[model samples]
Each structure stands twice: as C-alpha cells, then as structure tokens.
Target: MKTAVEKAADTDYRELSVSPHLITEAKSALMHFERLCGRYQQMYNTQVQANKLFVVKAKNARMYISHFVQVLYMSIQRTEIKEEHLSLYGLEECNMIVPDISTNEQLLEWGRKIIEGENIRISRGAVPIYNPSIAKVKVMYTLFKEGYQTQKLHQKATTRVQDEVAAYREKVDKLILDIWEEVEKDNMDLATDQRLDRNRQYGVIYYYRKGERV
Candidate 1:
C-alpha cells in the first residue's frame, strides 16, 4: 500500500492533482518502514537462532557436568581424598548431590563455580579427571555464554525496532490514506474500472473478498 503511494507521489501526483509534499512524506515514511522492517527481521532472526544455539550449548554443558561428576566420584575413590574434598569440586556432598542447575542463569553460576573449584583443586596437587574433564566443561559453558549474550543483545534491538515501528505506524497509514483519497477524487469523473486502473498506476490498493473474482 505504501509502495503504491510512494510511486504515485513521485510520478502520478501531478496528473492526479495531488500535492507534491505527499511524495516527500510518503518517501520518508516508506524509507523508514523499509529500514525498520529489515532491522527488526535481522534482530528477530539473530535472537531466535542464538537462543537455539544457547539451548544446545547449555544442554551440552549440563551433560558434560554430569559426566564430570560421575568421574569425580570414581577418581576420588581411587585417591586418598576425603569426603571434605568434594567441596573442592563445587559439591557439598559426595553422593551425587548436585545443585539444581536448570535455568540458564543457574547453569551459568553453577558452571563457573564448578570450573573455578576444579581449577583450584588441580592447582593444589590434585590430579585432573580424565575424559569429560573440567576443561571440556568449560568449553561448553563458554559457548553457552556466547550464545546467551548474543540473544540478549538482539532481543533488546528487536524491542527497540518494534517500538519505533509502532510509533510510526499511524503516520504512515494516514499518509497513504490521504494520497489515496486525493487520487480517487481527481479521477472520479472516469468510469469505475477506468478510475481503478488509473488509481492502481498511482499506487492504490484494492482488497477483494475471499473466493470473489478479482
């Protein structure tokens, strides 16, 4: 609808006896709409895709953490470390008692503490667990963090674009309506079909009922 209005204002306004100012207004509105739509689409896509990646990364991190805990139990059993040593691996109990790291925020805090505790323990002459070790868990957590931050950024961008689009929507609608009315009034002397054809050349929109002939 706005596209037709823009072209009408540019090339058909003089013929349709419409004001030239409508052309500039339509162009500005159309340009802003185009930019807003493009930006909004980009932000929405980034948010969606980033969130999906974050979910996968988060799941991967959770799986690795579970594996690390299993290995920690076995590894500690073979060592001289006591139950008190469980705290060094970010666990309070030695019997598979893990925190409820479900939400992304919880997972973030859990993973960070686990990595830090493991690092501290390893530095204190503790052997690093093999296979699904803290290093691997850290990698997964880092990926999850990256995806989470990206999704957050684009979510805000999408919201800002939505607000701008909302604020400008009525203005664009009014401009298009004004241009349509002026063009139709100028071409009113012609037959309905002829006037419709003329109006279309000036960017007029027509809506036909469903199942009705065009």
Candidate 2:
C-alpha cells in the first residue's frame, strides 16, 4: 500500500540506532549556519574578504552534515522494529527537527519582540534585531538573561551616581555660603578698625587692640 520512500518518511529517527550526540552536533551546526547567513546579509564588503575562511568552513560543515545525515539515515533503515521505524528528516520538516528562526516569519516576530522588550536599545546603525539560533536556544537564553541583568545593574548604578552628585552639589553650595559670610565679617571688622584709627588720630576717641590698649 505504501512506497518505500513514503514509509521511510513516516519512520521516527528516534527509534533508530542514531547517536544522540551526533544529532545534537548536527542541529547546532545547522543553527550556527543560519545565524551566519543572517550576519552575512548585513556584512560590508571589507568583512567579506576577512570572513572568507569562515564562509568556507560553514559551507564545508553544511556539506558534511548533509552527507552524514544521508549515511546515518540509510544505516538506520537497515534494521526495523515492530512498533515505530526511525528515519531522518530535514531541520524543519519534522517536530523534533530544529526550526530555522531565520525565516521571515520568525525574524519578524523576533523584531517585534525586541521592540517591545525592556532595557533593549537599538542604535541607529546597529543591527535591527538579533537572529534566532535554532538548536542553541539555550545559548541565546543565557546571553539574553545576562544582558538583561547587566542593564538593570547599570541603571541602578547611574541612579545612585546622580543622587550622590546632587547631595555633593548641595554641600558645596552651603560651604560656599559659609565662606562668603566669614569673608564679609572679616572685611567689616577691618573697615571699622581703619575708621577708628582715623578718628583717634583726630583726638576723637581712645582705642584698644584685641587684648592691650595703645
């Protein structure tokens, strides 16, 4: 009733003899490749030359992954179980396959979320949005968590600094007023002493120095 290819398509790769580690590595590589593609779209010509080697590596890794998947799929097809047969599928074709969030729909959603997300600043020249990593959601989650905490700490520090500056300015103003009062009092005393000396010279009065009369 069903062709071999169709039956193969329905097989569950999880039930097969595939190595979970290799599958995890393949998924990570695919996500990394997609992220690179997003970055490549925004790169300048200068970066193209500098990133040539990375590009080559991504391409080779992609090819290796494709080849490995095919081999693994074929090897797994050799043995069949009574319940569910295991088969390999592309990154997006099956439930367990990682989704390429680099797609237009996913990217648009990410951009909207970033616009609404707290403490996220988009520079005029900065990349519009972060590209989503597929299988490496754990990595993205860690980075975003760290970034959010760091931003909150920075805001708290800035607020404290502002309060300290305001208090310092008030203290400085009070000190200045006190110094001015002292200076004015000293000047008035000196002027009164000069006037008394003139008056005494004209025989108008007697005067006393701070402790002893003269």
Candidate 3:
C-alpha cells in the first residue's frame, strides 16, 4: 500500500554515500513518468467523452428513423387519403399500401446497419497513442529496474522504488486496456441485438426492482 510519492522518496537517496548525480537522475525520470501519467489520463477522458457522444447520436438517429417509419405505417392504414392530410403529413411517396410488418422489418434492418457502422467507426476511432503510452511506460520502468540492480548503497530503498514503478506501469496499462475493452463490449452488444426485438425498439430495458437503488 505504499503511495507512489512515498516510493519516489525511497529512491531519492536516503544513504549519505549515494551520489547526488544518481539521485538527480532518478528524480528527473520519476517526474517525466508522472507527467506521462497525466497525459494518459487526459487522453482517456477525451476518448470516453467521444465514445459517449457517438453512441448518443447514433441512438437519437435510430429513434428518429423508427418514429418516422411508424408514422408512415399509421398513415397507410387510413381507408381514404385526404388532400389536407396529405400536404400536412407529406404523405405523397407513402400513399401506397405498405404493411406494418414489412415496415417494422425494414426499420430493424436499418437499425442493424446503423449499429454495424458504429462498430466500424469505433474500431477505427481508437486513440493512436493508447498502445504507445503503454510501451513508453514499460521503457520508463526499466530505468528504475536497472538502477535497483546496480545500486551499491540503499539497496532496499532502490528495490522498493523499482517494484513500485513496475506496479504503477502495470496499473496504468491495465486501465487503458480496460477502457478499450468496455468500448468493444458495448459495440459487440449493439451488433448482437439484431435478432432481438429490443433492437427494433429502444434496446434492452433495465426494469426497476422494488428495493433497487436508482
């Protein structure tokens, strides 16, 4: 449970015999690693926001299309078409007798395509630096490992810092990967809903249980 700052202090030269040059190098490397962590966090936030917006817009578009087709189906059910109603509803092209079942099926097909397109877009829109950041963290971690291996003085202090750096890198890499995994899972769920009636509607519902928290 050692904090990252505490681990950094461990390598900041506790031994009187440790050279100032080595201490300076270690401090500088740690600072750079922290800065990279900040950048990675910012990148992650941006990507999450982008993903949310993309999904929301897609849902809105699908809703609009579904509603439009529903309206068209309802209009076609009329026994006689009126001139005023025709102009008001703009039902010129939709004047023909279109079955409700066929209309719903077309809407479902459109929804599937929308989801498929979104999956492709999400796959292509992944942050370019995501993987490279993990690689950079691994490289930065090697500095501490090498220092720990060669240190003549404060061996225990160096070891603590080296292990901490490794842990930090692993944590960061896992976080980035987890975010990517969530996005992929979301897209997969959308694509898989093609067979379900939920896709034709507004997707799966989260019904309220009696005691469940909102």
Candidate 4:
C-alpha cells in the first residue's frame, strides 16, 4: 500500500521539475495535480495505520496462544491422563511443541480444548497443571477470539481502501498523461526521438525492453 502511494508521489515530484517555459504554460497546473495525489497518499496512510494496529494485536494474540499451549503441554507431565488422550488437553499428538504454521483459528480451538479438558480434570480431583489456572487461560482465549474478529474487520476495510488507492493511482496516471501529451503537442515539429528526449527534461519517463537503452 505504501509502495503504491509512494510511487505516485515520486512521479509527481519528478514531473514538477519541468522545463522553464512550462512555468506559465503548465507548471502551476502540474502543481495542482501533485497536490491531488499528495492528498490521496495522506488518506491512504490513515488506513495503513489502522491496519497495522489490527496486525500487531493479532500477532500478540497468536503469540500468547502459542506460549500457553507450549506451557500446558510441558505441565502435562504432572497430569494423570494417559499419552493416547493427551490431545484432549491441547497437546498435539502428545507433543510439547506447537506447530510453526498454527493460525489464529487453530490456536483458538486449542484454547477451547485446554479449558474444557482442564475443567473436566479439575472436577475429578486432578491438580491444576500450571500456575495460570484454566479459568484465567479461558479469559485470554476469549479476548483472543474478540481480537481475531476485529482483525478480520480491519483487513476487510483495508482491502476496500486499497481498491480506492488503485482508483486514485489511475486518476493520477491520467493527469500525468494529459500533461505529457500537451508537452509533446507543443513540440510537434521536432523528430519523434528528439521530441521524446525533450520531454525527458520534464521528467517524462519512457520504458525500454530488456537489454535496450536510449
């Protein structure tokens, strides 16, 4: 997202450094377009900041769940449950390590199992596994679930903003094209390559194929 806005900014900045005569002919108008793109880039930043908040919160939640599962698995040694049913306590196949690719949904599911299994065990006179009780762990999972939903909403909103940025880019590109076209028209008598070279002085970029040059 930042890249898209920054690219448009770069183009506008370069084009603003145009040939001297264009000061009266086009430079002021060019500044207007530059400011238009700048305004949209600022708008895009608001969405960027909002999306970052959700991303950071989601990461924190994932980290907590991963840690909680790992700690619970290690504490399973103090439990009376047999190895075959260890997954009921959220230990994956009785292993103490959480998978590297575990997602928020998967982590939340593990949290559910940990609380339920722990509660059942507590009912039967089983000692609590770790220092943070299952009740407290349940609280963490509940908060984590809430954050997951918030993260989803933010992601969707950010996607919509990204589409708007795309539209803004197109609008800016058209403005640039109009300016470049007028500049070319003003130099219509010059040879094509010569005229293009003149436009380059106004920061009008031209693309070349691989291994090609001016």
Candidate 5:
C-alpha cells in the first residue's frame, strides 16, 4: 500500500540512521586529523632545531673569520716592512683561516683578477701587484662571501616554508571542526534520540536498521 515516493523517503531515512560504519569512518577522520596535526608539529620542531643549529654554525663561522682577519691585520701592522719588503715577497699561499668565508665567491673573483694581473690598489698611492698567491687569497675571500650569502638565503627560505606549513595545518584543523559541526546539525535526530556521540571527528554516522541497505 506504500507509494513509491514514501518508500524512497523511508529508505533514505533508514540509510541516514546511525551505524557502526559511520563510527569507523569518524574515527578514521580523527586519526587523519591527528596525523596532520602531528606533521605540522614535527615540521615546526624541525625548523626550530635547524635555527639552533644555524646559530652554532654562525658562531663558528664568525670565529673563523675573526681569526683570518687577525692574521691579515698582523701582516699589515708590520710597520717595519715597507713597499720594498713586499716587493721582494713572492705570492704567499692562501690558507683557509675559516673553513668557509662568507664572501668567498667575491674573494675568488678577486683572486682570478689578481691572476689576470688585475689592478690591486694596496695603499691609496701603492701600485698594483700581480702576485699569484695574493690572487688565491682573493679567490678564497670571494668564496666565503658567496657561501655566507647562500646559507643565509637557505635559512630564510626554510623559515618561510615552515610558517606556510604551519598555517596550512591550522586551516585544515578548522575545516575538520566545521565538518564535524555540519554533520552534527544534519543528523541531530540520530545524535540526540539514538544517544549517539555526536562530538566525534569527521562526518556523521549513518546507521541502518537490521537488514537495511546502509
């Protein structure tokens, strides 16, 4: 005696009823949410750790630079030596006072110029010297500069990525909350009458009576 429309509606309502499958699906959603949240947390933690590491590296780099500069300052401070003293001096070997100098690339370029007999104005009135070893020092200096700049850029990029990832995680969390609210609203009858837990994460649980399609 039931009309086709009434039968269809009844079927739909039955399908909407709470079920174990819905609970499983909701639990899965919560797990997914937990995973996403954990991912963000891990990324944030990694960035923090990286920053700490950079601080240590930066300090070490500074120390090396200071040591190299000290050596150069000492060499220049030798007032006893005049132009003649250096004129007789051959190219001194360039040593890495610091494993990496911030301006090493620039120094390297300068080194190449030195090799090519590039004009190196020592004192305001001093003539350019074409020393093989001095060219090497310039090259090393250039390398240091390049290395420092590159590392600094990388650090900034890493920080930016971390921030973006964190923001994304927050947005996803909000979406999950909204989804849960919507599911709760649409299935209030089942949630309230069935005494089902509506606060679960993910979509609402749709249950079917025994021998039901859902």
Candidate 6:
C-alpha cells in the first residue's frame, strides 16, 4: 500500500502533454518578435535624431547668413552706397535678385524630404527579410498548436492535476493530525506519572495508611 506522503508526492508530479518541439517553436516565435521590436526601435531613434540634428544645423547656417547680410546692408547705407558701388564686395555687376526658396519653412520641408528618402531606402532593404520572418512566426504558431492539441484540452488537464493535488494535500494533513493526536495522548499519560515522582523527590509525599510529613 502506498503511504499518504508517497501519494501526495505522486500527485505533485504532473506529466505535461506539450511536446518539446512545440516548446522550441514557441520560443523561436518569441525571439523573432523580440528582435523585430528591438531593431525597429533602434532604427526609429537613429533616424529621428539624425533628422533633428540636420534641421538644427540648417537653421544655424541660415541664421549666420542672415546676420552677415544685415551687417553688409547697414554698412552700405552708412556709406551712401549706390547699386554700382557693390563691386568692392567682390561683385562685377550689381543686380537685385530674388530667391526661389527663401524661407525657414522651405528649408524644413527639404530636410523632411531627405529624411523620408532615407527611411524609404531602409524599409525597402528590410522588406525581403522582414516578410519571411513574419511568415515563419505564423507557421511556427500553427505547428505549436498542432503539437499541443487544443487549448481546451490543455486547460482541462491542468485543472484535473490541480484538483488531484488539493485532494492529496487534504489526505496528508488528516493523516498527520491523527498521528499527532495519538502521540499527544501517550505523552499526557506519561506526564501524570512524571509529576507524581517529581513531587515525591521534592519531599511532598502522599500516603493512604497514615500521615507522612517530610
């Protein structure tokens, strides 16, 4: 006959119906997802930082040119300069010119287009590898499900194991309580005899025939 403790231990040992192949496939799927998230996040941060730095440098360049133009205009005004007098500033001929792109908005828009182009190139390069990785994850999931059977069956088996464990624990506890109660009763009977002997040793004795004093 199996002891209560042995039965309890057996109840705790549950055989998983899931196959090792399914576990390996599931892990591969998780790893793929992790890599995809990490790679995309890294690329996104790099592109954003690059774009911001490009915009900042362009703005600084524009500011420096604007300051130089303003100083030149003020000096020309103070000297009572005419259009032809611009030759001193390295110009053979003087003519008023209007620029096609002369605003901060236009500069920012051009920077955005460059950033977009770079992102497109990166995405195009990744497409061949990215699409296949996604398909592999899908295939792995299908195989994992086939190996493990249905989700409902897995859940029912798990619940059954849990119930067995609970019942085994209950039986183990009752067995322990019964053993303890028997030991405690024997200890109580021994304790009464011990108390009487201890009293006699301390010189307080009781006798039925006559009074014995110590």
Cα lDDT for residue 110, candidate 3: 48
Error of 2 at 54 (Å): 24
Name the better of 1 and 2 by lDDT. 1
Query: Global lDDT of each model?
Result: 0.78, 0.37, 0.40, 0.60, 0.45, 0.39
Q: TM-score order of candidates, best first?
A: 1, 4, 5, 3, 6, 2
CA shift of 105, model 6, Å: 9.7
Tens-digit per-residue lDDT, 8-96, candidate 6 = 23332232112333334434443544455465555555555655654555455444333433443444567533434333333223243
Runs in model 6 with CA error above 4 Å? 1-23, 71-214
7: Cα error in model 4, Å = 22
Candidate 6 Cα lDDT to native: 0.39
Lowest summed lDDT over 10 consecutive residues: which window, candidate 4?
Answer: 1-10
Q: Tens digits of per-residue lDDT for model 2 on 1-214? A: 0121122234465532223343344344435444554444434333445345444433433333334334333433554211122221222233333233333344333323323321122232322222232223333333444444444455565555555555555544443344334334333444667745533332234446888854
What's model 5's overall lDDT?
0.45
Please provide, for model 5 over 13-76, each residue's C-alpha lDDT reduced to its tens digit, 9 standing for 90 to 100: 3443333344344445545555665665666666567556555544544444345344443554
Lowest lDDT sum, 10 consecutive residues, model 3, at 195-204
TM-score of model 4 relative to the true fold?
0.53
Task: Itemize residue pairs with steric clashes in candidate 3.
Answer: none
Q: Quick one: best TM-score, which candidate?
A: 1
TM-score of 5: 0.37
What lDDT score goes with residue 9 in model 3? 53
lDDT of candidate 3 over 1-214, digit per residue (tens): 1122233355434421224443344445557568665655555555556555444444444445445434434534653223333323233444543223223335344444423432343366632122223233333333333332333234444455555667677655544344334334434454444423322221222356899873
Better of 2 and 5 by lDDT: 5
